[model samples]
Target: MRILALDAATEGCSAALIGPDLALSRFEVAPRRHADLLLPMAEELLAEAGWSLHDLDALAFGRGPGAFTGLRIAAGLIQGLALGADLSVVGISDLAALAAGARRSAGVNRCLVVNDARMQEVYWAAYDFDDRDEPRCLGEEQVAPPAAVVAPAGEWYPAGNGWMAYPEALATVHAAANGPVAAIHPHALDIARLAASRVARGDAGSAADAIPVYVRDQVARKSA
Candidate 1:
């Protein structure tokens, strides 16, 4: 399966290409520079792999519960790329991607992905890895103030920038440490890998379906 994925969620920008024998990617925490860096990163990965958009089976992006601008950047790019390439597209949750990344980097079975959604709130989700080692979301993703956040009971490690953002408010969860490893973020490689399964199952959508999931939509309006 040949899949190309991009993510400009949070403070990171990245692009990745996954083929049967090849995996190429680039990532950087370049705040507000995603628009400038994302395309070039994608182009570089394609060039390194000697592939074009048409050569890919699908295009994927981190469809968010992230910064609105960052989410739109990735989704809009995938929409354009998918349409031009005539390829199916998949939207992977940025929160879920962070959980998958937590599993990958920390070898944790149960992970709590929490990202700072600003305004003293966080976007969060709980995940438990399946037997196949794929992240299985336990409940709906939500946006809440750090003081109101609640995690499932277990030896779970906190992940994403949220922990660092409100170390005091989230201290209970942080104190319940499953080992000091509470920092993770979305990555294009993880997005691509997650999309690979969806693509295989024919669960992907058309180019027009590429869209961001702003979990904080209602919350933002109410707060405002």
Candidate 2:
């Protein structure tokens, strides 16, 4: 199966292509240039893979609990690509993607995913990987002040910028737990892998169903 995935739910923007034997990707940390970089990055990945948008069987993207603008940028691109290609779409949670990234990088089974939500808050979620290497959300996704966010009891590796943003919360959680933190970003590669699993399970949805999952919409405002 050929799948294309993109993520712009934070300071970083990335696009990736997953083919039968190989995966190609493009990533950049362009905080204010997501709109400008995402498509071009997608184009580059597709070009490198020698495939067009229509060649993809499905489209996947970071749905959110992230930057409002970044979430919209990714959602809009996924909608356009899926609609134009007549392909199924899957919206992967940004927090889940972060957890998957940590799992992929650190080879850990459990993770605490958090992204800086601005406004002195964060987008947080806890996940544990199943035997098939898919992240299962352990709790509800939320946007809240770091102090109020509680980690699931037990041993788990912490990940994402939220830990860095709220070191105290991370410390409090890890001090009582068994494992340490593993800092990582949600990469497009992880999104593609998760999307592939969704597609295989017949979980892809229509383009109209491709919606951003913004936990805190009001936090995303145009600055004067």
Best by lDDT: 1
Mark the 10 consecutive residues where model 2 has the least summed lDDT: 174-183
Candidate 1 local Cα displacement, residue 109, angstroms: 0.4
Which residue pairs clash within candidate 2? none
Candidate 1 regions exceeding 4 Å error are: 218-224
> What is the TM-score of candidate 1?
0.95
Each prediction's TM-score versus the true structure: 0.95, 0.93
What does candidate 1's lDDT look like per residue over 29-58, in tens digits?
999999999999999999999988888999
lDDT of each: 0.88, 0.85
- Residues 1-224 of candidate 2 have per-residue lDDT tens digits of 89899999989889989989979999888888999999998998888888888888999999987888888989999899888889999999988998888887777778878789988888888899888889999978988888776777667788888877888765766565446566557889999999999899999999998899888857556767
Best by TM-score: 1
Assess candidate 2 and give its TM-score to the true structure: 0.93
